[model samples]
Target chain A: MTPLAAPKALDSFFLEARCKILDLAAILDRINRGQGAGAVDNDPRLDKIRKALEVLHDQSGGRAERIQQIFSLDYDPGWDKPKPRY
Target chain B: MYYIDPHIHMISRVTDDYHRMAYAGCVAITEPAFWAGFDRGSVDGFRDYFRHLTEVEPKRAAQFNIRHYSWLCINAKEAENVELSRGVIQMIPEFLNKPNVLGIGEIGLNKNTKNEATVFQEHVDLAMKYHELILIHTPHLEDKYKGTRMIIDMLKQDRRLKPERVLIDHVEEHTVRHALDNGFWCAMTLYPTTKCTPQRAVDIIEMVGTDCIMANSAGDWGKSDPLAVPEMIQEMKRRGHADSVIRKVVYDNPLAFFRQCARWQEWPAETEVEKAKRKPAKAHA
Candidate 1:
């Protein structure tokens, strides 16, 4: 089966994507306006979000998976080992 | 546009949710046993939950012309209490004979802890002993990749469990290929937030094709939507996918998966005219 034609796919979703980008921008603006904003300037999660935004601009495809990985946990080799209960 | 939510938690949803889902063309659904927000104190708590899954929920769904089937297990959250989990696993066989019972599932890891793994293997033993199918719950955001890998390794370690007889739920963009590459059936949980959205699910379908895969709402005692599968159908249509391609993913793939169970019964039988109406599309990807 042929993949969704890139031009048609973009045309179908442009408005929805525009709305989501607006939502993300509004969310970040709200976060910056909050009282605790300065304290979170160096937060790693925010850094990751920034990195994910950078990924969105890349011309190479697969941005969805790359962005998902940006927010996902790094694989821990010893995750199955016994650990202290919190 | 008829679809099946291969994984959903109707026990946590209201009757109106079922009404809405039925109107959205949900013909059937399978509710996997999952955490009840908090850990229960004992095995009897789980027994009552199972009774609800196997008994009450099916009747509730039937009111809306929806066929409800369920998987049985002590979910990972409660499985941390190994002693209680064992008792629950031992008692699961009591409901195995119930007409709606499908297999053992939503049964894998949460934090990828050793105790969770221990109980998961025990559930596998119970499932294997009964010749039942298995369904797994991979962990959430931070732990998901590792947790899914751990669950796959554990299942692979047990030679008696065939990959086809098991399904790994909650697969995302990064982990979906791994689950499918290993030969196990997989599902994407479409949520309004946190998990895959309708658009992302459609993207995954485009990337992976439609074989041996399915999607679900996983609607439960949280922020979720019971009509997520239909939302995916709409997204597929908007992307210009053929109806046959959309139907195969939402309807045919789930039916093919569930039909593997020993007690599996045909549901909502389609008439010859209905079959003729849905022209077969090319079945690639």
Candidate 2:
């Protein structure tokens, strides 16, 4: 019989959290770069990118399932909104 | 290479304190006014104490090449008598703007009484009014945690007070979270018999990290040490804390704190200090 996988150590969750936070940071950078550089969004590909990012940044509680879930996890919807003119 | 005691009571201390602190490589000290040996009876008591703290202790520390900083406030224990303490609080402005007066501090609840709570709120108001940093003195024994929370609530009422500038002193195991979660700087007092031991302080530093954690020798009427700050630093060093971490906790943090004092260096000695007045006030009682 195949041996079961080794049990996780206490730091596994913390390490996972650190990786997730870093991943979020990288995605945010990419989106900001796209906006600042005035990247064209005519392709259907850009729609998929924006949708994915919207979900990931706004998550509430239970763990996300797939990379899509990471994108779909809405934390602060207004976080990426443009500033209002006074 | 050097350490700072962020919350010592040098006015209630002795001459040997200067010698011992110098031996510890204590380059600077911050003395927050607390009970002041006995309950100060009048506003003049505060005036005299402030003069001594600003004018006297600096002279004392200079002999040992130690810089002294003073925090003027009505202590928590004294808060039990709100009427008398209010009289004292009114006089804080006289010296708060004086030289080396780092902040309005060492003020919080004692005995968890209403009188203590009221005085605590009063201190918060005064600190917020002046945009001064606060130095909180938590109650000893059972009231430590409760008093810390009470002080935090009062602080929250005023959005003007920033957590970075406020220092909560004399925290034990149970009192740390309230200080940290509130975003205030955390200070541990190493009193040999009662508050915290040097070894326990090491354990705390290991758990909390050194960003805003500082250790002090809060030696008052209790059995304590003038070298407790250095002893705690030594313990952390022997336990393998980095030199940078030691500097942040002991030197950088206190120096930055004193620098933020509203009028810390403005009030030089009003009284012409007689020659060679660098003797610690062991005999002030």
Candidate 3:
């Protein structure tokens, strides 16, 4: 069984989110390149975004499942159930 | 959607981030003194950092129309050097009266070490002596629960320190109750990884109502987002929370907390609010 297959709705949502992240990266790249020759190679803000993109780019094999597991919230349906007599 | 980031490390953030935060309705922010990604050599280093927090950063934030406030302290990570910590603590009072200065904070246990606890109590003593508000930074992951308890125990031991005046930040499911039950304010930090995510923060807020609770980005040199509070607002919206409820968690609550600071002044004056309301609408040509 493939645990990576999300429901159709969530898959669509993740796709749109991925596109927006890439769009942001492109805009940042454009701004960085627009600086021409004098731009300092090390900017904290750009560095952070690059690190975040690297995390995104590294989502291959079982890494995607692991990411989902790390972030998943647990909801107990029977949280309010009456306790059994001991 | 105007909100205040109750705790952020803007010293590590860029000016462009400030512009974006201001545009996104951040009218104010409070930066707590935390580790600068490394250990410094002397008390003079902390003095300079405090000056930047109270002087330079305020001016930079003001350029974007954001009111910047700061808390002064030798963070727990640096508190390991008890000698340097004591020196920095002795010098903090010089900046206590700075208009932008809030109080002594981002002070708490890093590894729950004995030296860290001694320095933590000393900083608390300084805060009590000066009547300054306190902001706490609890340990991360495995240490969080135990460290939060130790910090709380230390705080409880000080009879003069009022619980309400202290904010224990970076609270999670296992620790939020301890802060609130003890009557201290709590903050959930929204980070991309390692700490509470926006959804988890919202869940915690749902489990525990908005009283004495708030959220922050904790945006710093590490991986974080300055716009994380807005992302939490979005999460609240998706979960059917009201605008007023969201505003309470993001805006009103932080304002309420900051008002306790000896130096905090009211922002967005009534006259300014009235002026904005009274302005006539422009017609298209």
Candidate 4:
């Protein structure tokens, strides 16, 4: 389905979006400011977060759903089968 | 514009939150037993928690004219302790007949472990044996999609559990269609962080038509808002959605889901005098 028009959508949600973006920036800054840069350098979750950030710049819609998928587990076809936790 | 928060943990919230919710036009709420912020060591802990849900919280909500209902379970986080989970599950039936008890839920997976799955099936077995409705909590963030997929699979395996009578909660844009397309009812939780915001929840509603789906605050002992559903109402209003459409997601849909429970009562059951007083008004209109 098509998204609501930008002006109408922005009128209601622009501030919320701005605040969230600021929060994300501050979070990244905090991570950068932390002493242990190497700790997160190879962290897969951080990699995923970076990939999700790249998703935000796409012109086409569905970014939200795509980013959610980026954070979500890939669909495991055999997920119902019980597996041991490491 | 009155609405029902189909899933919130009222036991974790202050009485003032209930008052604020009432003022914001929340007419009713359903609280599912969940992680108490820390795991309890014994089934007795859960037993006492159940009493608080079925007894204490309902009384608290009544003061503000908001109807309170609850579900019972040892949450998925605690379900890893299979022995304790079983003990809690066995004791759950004692509360099933209580006036405000809804069904077995917020019962799914946290880590989607083997032990968690075992506990989940046992809870499902208990629910099916009692013919009670089910409410499921899909795991959060990274584990959500897989956990939700597994939850739906497990439920489908049980021929006795009807899809429509179950609700898979905390579904986001990715998982919403899975729950709905599988014939189960689903709820999107509106959270200030880490879940759908009011704007995103409205976006989901825009993407997926309002049918067999609803939204809730899922307010609990976290950095969450009890008025999140009201904020969703505001968001929908700003987008120029019809009030009827908003009402369906927030009001009628939840009532329809809860009405399936045999124990669910008609709230504010009108007195005969009040019924008579209302009939004349209806006739004039």
Candidate 5:
């Protein structure tokens, strides 16, 4: 099976998403660290997943934000309309 | 002149509601994806639903001069089917940046099972990934207590959540404090049949100080009303609560929350032209 790479917009999204996931993993580590190491059901392999999400979030923040500026701009809230004169 | 009902189901409501809302001065709204008492089977079902929520409904409300917005998610009751539900959920981000799609949910527990847990976590991940607000739809009936517990526990795991940005819906007398105590904004649905009532909600606000509490009708196939906010406001007034308190819970709270979304940034206040357009519409209605 071929690994699917993201489109420009989706890549930006995945990048930011990966960052948050890693941040979450860090919190889990902090808790487990304080709980004296045996508190969590640990799998050392999960560290790879955590690191990847962190890297993606950081790298995507720059590129995806630029692409989002070009493609994902939105304007639908009723705020821009002129206020009614009663 | 500004009050936002952050969770109101207008799909089951009427054009009269649009008029009523504008007249009562509804500034904005957020409709969560909720059960309509029947199962919606397939991704196409949710696709059509999300489109209606984002497109058709907002257009209808525009004619009445009310700003409409909503959340995109697989309803929890339907989330019972994990694979089928994820297929629907996976299609959500396609519409996430739509004029109305504020967040990934109205997603939380129903039967408090693992699939509910699985989908809830995925919904949280999507929300965190997108940096969008999460409007969690907690379960109803006796299952609500256990379900809210699961919702909080899972949320505690997700570090991306700010706690304040997570809105837990369908809170009752007992679980209301738990949701607030945990630092999450709590939304109580003022349904006629099964959820919290308006007077009781006021009592809650009185005790809880209306800090992070808000109300919605969440009117669906079951009996409900879109006027639940105004009714609650009137009740709070009748109870002699200060006008500032009334504005906080019924008005300012939701306004502040909806404006946090990047999509609602473009909404403008109604103008003379919009009023001119509204006059003809009211006569027709």
Candidate 6:
């Protein structure tokens, strides 16, 4: 099978997305600093954002691979395995 | 240009979101019971949530001229607690007759566990007893395909469930056919991330053609867009899809599905100009 060429537009798209992420992180940092420790504590939204950022930071793949993984609907056969209870 | 968001978590959204949605040409929305970002400790929490869905959110949406409908269920995430799920399921009938209450929904699998499946079947049994419409939520990411398959199998096993009355939501390319081919309705959720984008949703429509298909924002407390259906409309227009085609996917299809509700009232089909000429009056609660 022929490998798909990367879309040229996505280069700028990802760059712009990264800038927005950084800008959001900066704003959140500023808010945290201004609010001090008490205000940040037990805020579920902040915790969720922090966890999402950690997941992004922990991703090992390149941007193209990550984008494909995020958007594609390809089924994983391994998902048939039994999952643990929440 | 008016549309119906067949599924959204409006309780998680603010009043301004409803105002913006009304301005964006949304006439109606149906919110399925979903995970409240965290699990509740007792059945009383779900009871209050149900009251909020049936009582409060409807009034809130009405302030902006948007009709609000809701489904009752112990969401799949919380279904893991089988005891609490059963209690919530038994209590669901108390609110099922509420004017704005739609049916049982957002009720499918989360982890594809045995307990989740058990609670799912019990919920199905209750819906069968009430003859209510069913709305399903397939799992996310890697679990979606298998989870959807499992849900389909379960639905098929229930002889009483008419496929057309059930809607399998969050269907993507690989999972869309499973829902449609079985004669059930399906929806694509347009989220900012981790779901169908507007372009992709339009592409799916082009591939599958618009039969029992629809799209929603699925906007919630998370990073999602409430204007996603409108975004899809713009994309479809840009791709030269006829206005009728866009309207079917966005407006007509959802109404068609929602019309099956026992309490659904038919609203008059009036043009924007016609609506404007009418005297302003308060909508019935």
Collision count for each candidate, in order: 2, 17, 0, 0, 14, 0
Tell me each candidate's TM-score.
0.93, 0.69, 0.75, 0.90, 0.70, 0.76
lDDT of 6 at B165: 93
Error of 6 at B79 (Å): 1.2
Reference contacts preserved by each model: 0.44, 0.00, 0.00, 0.54, 0.00, 0.04
Model 6 TM-score? 0.76
TM-score of model 3 (CA atoms): 0.75
First chain TM-score, candidate 5: 0.32
* lDDT for residue B197 in candidate 4, whole number 0-100: 87
Best candidate according to DockQ: 4
Rate residue B255 of model 4 by lDDT: 93
In candidate 5 the C-alpha lDDT for residue B101 amounts to 80
Give one digit per residue, the lDDT tens place, for model 3 in B1-285: 788998899999999999999988898999999999899999999889998999999999999989999998999998889999999999999998898888988999887777887888888888988899999999886567768887887787677878999999999877888899999999999987579889778868877898999999999999899999999989887766777788899988988988998788777565777456545668799
Write model 5 residue lDDT over A1-86, tens digit each, in one string. Answer: 11123464365357766886688778777867775566344654345444444545565443322322222113222212111111
The CA lDDT of each predicted structure is: 0.88, 0.72, 0.83, 0.88, 0.73, 0.84
Q: Which pairs in model 6 have colliding backbones?
A: none
Find the 10 residues in a row with the least total lDDT in model 6 chain B: B273-282
Top-scoring candidate (TM-score):
1
Off by over 4 Å in 3: A1-86, B270-285
Query: Higher DockQ: candidate 3 or 4?
Result: 4
Worst 10 residues of 4 chain A by lDDT: A77-86
- For residues B5-93, write the lDDT of model 5, one tens digit per residue: 88888888878887988888787777888776788878898889888899999899889767788888887888778897879767888
Task: List candidate 5 segments past 4 Å from native.
Answer: A1-86, B266-285
Q: Predictions ranked by TM-score, top down?
A: 1, 4, 6, 3, 5, 2
lDDT of 3: 0.83
After superposition, candidate 1 runs with Cα above 4 Å error: A77-86, B276-285
